[model samples]
Target: MKLIKWLRNILNYRKFNCRRRALFSLKCCLVCKKPTKRGCNCLNGSIDKGTASLGPCLAIIAVLLILIVSFQYIIQIHPHLVRETSLSTAINVTGVFLWLFVSVLFNHQSCVWISPGYAPKCTDGYSSKYQNVPDEYFKYDPELKNDETVRYCKQCQTEKPWRAHHCRVCNRCILRMDHHCPWIWNCVGFRNQRYFYMFLFYLWVGTFFFIYFGYNRLFELYKVSSCILTFLPTIFCKLEENKIVVMNDNSLSWFNGRRYNDENQWFMFCYYACCGVNAVMLTFLMWNSFLLVNNQTTLESFQNLNAEMRKTRKNKKLRHFKYLYDLGSAQLNIQQVFGSKYYLALLPICYAPIGNGLLFPLRDQVHQIVFADTTNEPPNTKHLKVVTV
Candidate 1:
């Protein structure tokens, strides 16, 4: 009976529905199994599953659609536009569009492929460095009770340092976690945070490029369709019936039997798509820019907001709370995620933060500041240690 029960436990399967079909799974990474406890690369692969889930498959489809539409526009429509416009203007717009497209693709790949820095394993809730250290070593740390500087994650079975958070989707503690992005199908955290930001920036700009160039074409299509419906109702009816009707008027000669040409219809679809995508990207880009400038993650922003609300309730006059990791300089704050070289910060290459995600440099007053007790009266500084961790 004991042997049978152990075998049943080992063979246990969970049922989940995918595309209206319920499937049972065991240790397959493509299903519900936890990521292997090995290298970061394997962890990323297991989490993303390449094209296993709907989000990743959708993302792949979107990218391919964009590529196809853009190629069609460039080949079939851009030449006429170039002839109408000056050579310099066409060259410049094409260059900018190509750059934006390339940047978006590279950054998107980086965000999807990179691991969001996992918290290293620890022995008995303490890192290797602190495993044998005396209890008095952590006495000066003010973050937690009993002067413990590290937090243990039961899910990962590891010690998490400052800013680390456990992701339910990834099922592991990600160091400096921002949030899990469904579009990328990965966590935006310390390692891939910069890539994620660049991806948003490039995608936003690329959509804007499409919106700008396609605006005139979209307007022409709309005007001709409206004119056909208004002045030539018979022709419009023919178009609705899928019959080709050629307009005899010199001004309306551009209109064929179809309400709009196939290329024009595609351009219109892409234009509206860009408009919607741009709106979403704008909101995300602006929010992320604010977080980057202030040295906070999405999680930290919510945490700080809650802290402020609690403080406001305690003291009606206190409205603003200082974040511990701001570093006080916007340039320095931006440098924390991207590399120190300011010139290369805008580039969409591998310029991730150089530090192990386990530790972070604290603000000068982190030791002196207390979230619960924020009276104007300065706390005693003699015994406080300003440790960079």
Candidate 2:
């Protein structure tokens, strides 16, 4: 009886030991639990580190090739195109190509460091650390009793840059962020704002050219169709000086002191088709042009402004000429928007002296003042305040 009792106890102990071992093995991490990996706590290194997939590269290359081919064909067919009407077109094509190239380069070279999933710690203008506030406002730092320099990120467990916001999708901080651009595969921040603007400018130009050319072609087609319907069987005949003359599709002839030619008919058909196509294309171009002049992207413009305002209790300001120029001067005109020192360098042409063009200093000055006032405040603070009116 004593031996049997002992044996039963032994069996129970062995089973317990085996269960404990299994539990311990399960808890073991597959990968190293480093702060760098954000406690991935993974055991196997199967998780990707930072490189972008080859698929994006391949897709970009394919798109670029297609654009190049299409551009080549268009240029070949329209070799007689003048720069005046096609200036926008030239800019747009060049801009798109540049964007594509930059996107590819950024995707390949940009780092993919992770940032906090929440905001960073900061002192208010009064030097009070808004600790215990929501993470959206500021992160908390246990060590930062009165030290303004000490900061903490709940998720990142690291210090964030001043004016940095954590991007969940990119899993990192963006500096002086304007926005993220999937087309460029990069953030349109202080560093990349120039490229973004340039891209928009070029796109607008290209769209304009395409519309002009297409409109002309459409008109030409319409004329040819009308002529064929109204003047059939005598399609190659023309009246001159009360005399009818018949001519082939390529030659001129005179009959009864009247002259007619195939060249005239051909010219009419070409002109009509060109005009018709251009008119149709012009409509689409005009819409895009409106968006550019307003300085709003298609996505930004489509957002439900009322809903956004209701949720945030803020009134969104439109990017208009007044907000784009410098306004400290006595001049009170709109030209400041374009002729301000900031934009002067960016203008393609310089026929007029700085601050002396149409709206000149006034436009630029107003925009600058508006931009300064707006920029001084927090991005969501002034803009989010709803007006009763």
Candidate 3:
């Protein structure tokens, strides 16, 4: 390849500029034949598969369709939802559309641009020092707990903070990472976690808002569509001839499908789909809240859970579970993620975390136990790790 490039350069005999390159190689040949390639590079393959079980393409499609179809369907069925003047219906529909717009903007930004806190370049020195520690040191040894600082990551070629962990999809260590949320196409980390949770909150609210009033209309729509007692199947009769289908430019009526479009069935489908997605997002939001309130991250929870299980296997004794990061109270734990002010948790406003992402407020007793045995010098204490007990 180098020789080909060199010979081509010499034969061209022109200055190393864009215009010369475009004219030379083709200008020499009487016949200009070009073979253009399309689609993804064969060697590079696709990163979407590795990012999550549900690929990026599918996730993007799902997000867009829900945003559009749900709102359109909601407008069509607004009368059934809000029993008031047409002006009130317009306002309600406008609210749903505006909420969805915000969700899409932040969700797209979260997935494509946010950085998940990569380990810094200077951490290589810490990594070098960490390499000298014995392998058994990584194990949960109760006696050597306080000395287990400076975890070395082979992929990032640097040292990781106490709660930091490697994400194969992001291909780096993230500081205070919650999870690799594929839907957003980004890892939820220190910076964009606020956006991610906000997106979830809005999505839940928008969908549930539609469901709250539209539920009765949806049930009636479903009831009219099916009739086992009817002598013939739906396909056997001319749907138009049945005259049961109705459409109105002004009012809500039963089983009204448009001339070519089955409006009733389509509306039902959209409502049910939105309801299901809202349910999933609601569950995810609650789980995220639980993690935030307990002062635990998803990755940390996994490690702690596995460690507990392993200990149980050896001892085979029944024991109650405990949280190492728990601040001994739910309110303090919630403040750790949201802010010192309690109300910040309820709003989506941007607030800088109290800790600068490096140091954190550990439980008072645990903090003392972890650092008690160490001396107060950089050379002596920099390698000390936080012991989670």
Measured against the true structure, the TM-scores of the candidates, in listed sequence, are: 0.68, 0.33, 0.63
Summed over model 3, clashes come to: 3
Candidate 2 residue 38 Cα shift, in angstroms, is 16
Which rank order by TM-score, best down to worst? 1, 3, 2
Q: Per-residue alpha-carbon lDDT of model 1 for 297-319, expressed as tens digits? A: 99878756675433532223222
Give lDDT for model 3: 0.55
* lDDT for position 9 in model 3: 40
Give the clashing pairs for model 1. Answer: 245-257
Poorest stretch of ten by lDDT in candidate 1: 16-25
Better of 1 and 3 by lDDT: 1
lDDT of 3 by residue, 1-389 (tens): 42354345444433334344334433533243542222222111133233443435456675676666665545555655455447676577657666665665555555445665554534333355354443332232211233334456777776565466677765667767888876666688766666666677777877776666565555444444555546533222222223454446554443234522476656656666777778898898998887877878887676456755434322122122245567777877766665667565344345555553434455655544544544542232322333211
Pull out the clashing pairs in model 3. Answer: 111-184, 149-385, 246-256
lDDT of each: 0.63, 0.35, 0.55
lDDT of 2: 0.35
The segments of candidate 1 whose C-alpha lies over 4 angstroms from its true place after superposition are 1-14, 17-52, 123-150, 224-260, 308-320, 367-389
Leading candidate by TM-score? 1
Write the number of the candidate with greater TM-score, choosing between 2 and 3: 3
Candidate 3 local lDDT, residue 213: 56
Order of quality (lDDT): 1, 3, 2
Give me the runs in candidate 2 sitting further than 4 Å from their true place.
1-55, 58-70, 80-155, 159-163, 217-340, 344-389
